[model samples]
Target: MERMALGTEGIAVSRMCLGAMALGGVQDKETSYAILDRFVELGGNFIDTANCYMFWLPDGTGDESEHLLGSWLADRGGREDLVLATKVGRRPSFPGGGLEASEPLTSERIAASLEESLERLGTDYIDLYWSHRDDRGTELEDTVAGFDAAVKAGKARIVGASNHVAWRVERARQVAAATGAAAYTAMQNRYSYLQPRPGVRLPEGGHVHVEPGDIDYVGNTAGTALLAYSSLLSGAYTNPGKPLPEHYRHPGTDARLEVLDAVAAETGASRNQVVLAWLCGHESPIIPLVGVSSLAQLNEAADGLELRLESEQWQRLTEAA
Candidate 1:
């Protein structure tokens, strides 16, 4: 697998980042371990998880994903070979509290959360730590300083902003610069080849759609990368049973899907593969954070990374909407 530099941290990661949102929560232990093993065996080195992963599940306690990854790392015995990333700020302070009652990004909470996440993952340091979501109630300076402290203490090599708009991200970077703290070098948001109608809200809570400004910000900024979540729309592109979400059922979707199908036929690949290839070959160069429950899904995504799109086809896909 090809690797790309993550921000200015001097870290190289796989183009496709495996999202471990369901590793130990919804997915059984045997299936989760098998998926993790196959991902590593395929030369994948980037694995992303969060402290609150799958906590909404009926029997979850918000620690299943990280705990499972820790067990896998212990059994596999190759922690240094992979680029591990986890997040804070989205985990609820108490069980059954929900996302509305999630932890704030204050300095003290950041410190405490880092300690807890480290213990859960059974690692001394995190390659990349992310602010899972923006907390408007908290002072921006406090949040920036907290992440900076993590970098300063060597607990996290670099920091990122997830689910934040471009303007807020810029504001946070300004705060970091003024205070001489660590600025965010990476941006993670919900992005896909087929977009929703403008001004429509996503059904999923805490999901911020990537905007045009985000693309420009990442493209113009030096030493920064964009990690796109929901890049495949939860298998909506190819799965007959998984219909497109209500917000994505506009006319633009039909136009885009037509173009996408044409491209898939031209390349003799699955629709999912074409979408992943388009994302990897995007003008700004997006890293698709894919989550899978089975080995077949993982293998399909791996193959998608190997498929390169022609310039014309890429342009057509981009202009379809």
Candidate 2:
């Protein structure tokens, strides 16, 4: 796999980041280990997970993904070779299916959450740490300062934000600068080649989808890495069995699909590969966070690393929708 700068932190990682949201809980331990081994075998090192992953499972247990990675790292004994990333702040599901209280961005909460995450991952320091979502109730200054403290204390090398608005990102950076704290250098949001309809809300709460304006903002801003989740639209771009999401059911979706088909046919690539290639070759520093259940799917995603689209072809894909 090819490498890309994670942000302005002077760190680099594979362009494709494997998301382990389903590891351990939704996916069996044996299968998860196989996936991890295969990913590293293919020269992939960027892995994304969260402390609250798979809490919505029937048992409402969380931390399975991170715990699994911890064991894998222990057995592999090359933790320094990989870029480990995990997030916090979302409310995990409790044992009877109710949501537990979320950890806000207060200093105490951030510090405690980092301790728990480090313990679960079996690592002294994280490569990338994310605030899973914006805690609007808490002051942004406190959040920035807390993350800076993590870096200063050798708990995390760099910090990022997921599910945050562009203005909030800018404001947080500003606060960090003013307070001499570490600012968020990367952002993760719901993004794809196809877009949701105007005024259409997919996640409806703290999880916001990336809009065109967000794309423009990130591209114009320097020193920000944009990592896209849901980059394949949950396989709707490739699998016939998976329908396009409801929020993405816009009038232009058919046109986008047609363009994707044309691009794939022209490049002799799969539709999914073409979508990923588009993300990789975008003007901004964008990375695709892909989640896979099977080794075949993982290989298909990896194939995109070698596929390069022409400028005109990229423009066509961009203008399709």
TM-score each candidate: 0.98, 0.95
Over 183-246, each residue of candidate 2 has an lDDT whose tens digit, in order, gives 8888899888888888776654456788666677778877778889988877887788998768
**Model 1 alpha-carbon drift over 4 Å, by segment:** none
lDDT tens string, model 1, 33-60? 9999999899899999999988899978
lDDT of each: 0.92, 0.85
Colliding pairs, model 1: none
Could you tell me the TM-score of candidate 2?
Answer: 0.95
What does the lDDT read for residue 158 in candidate 2? 92
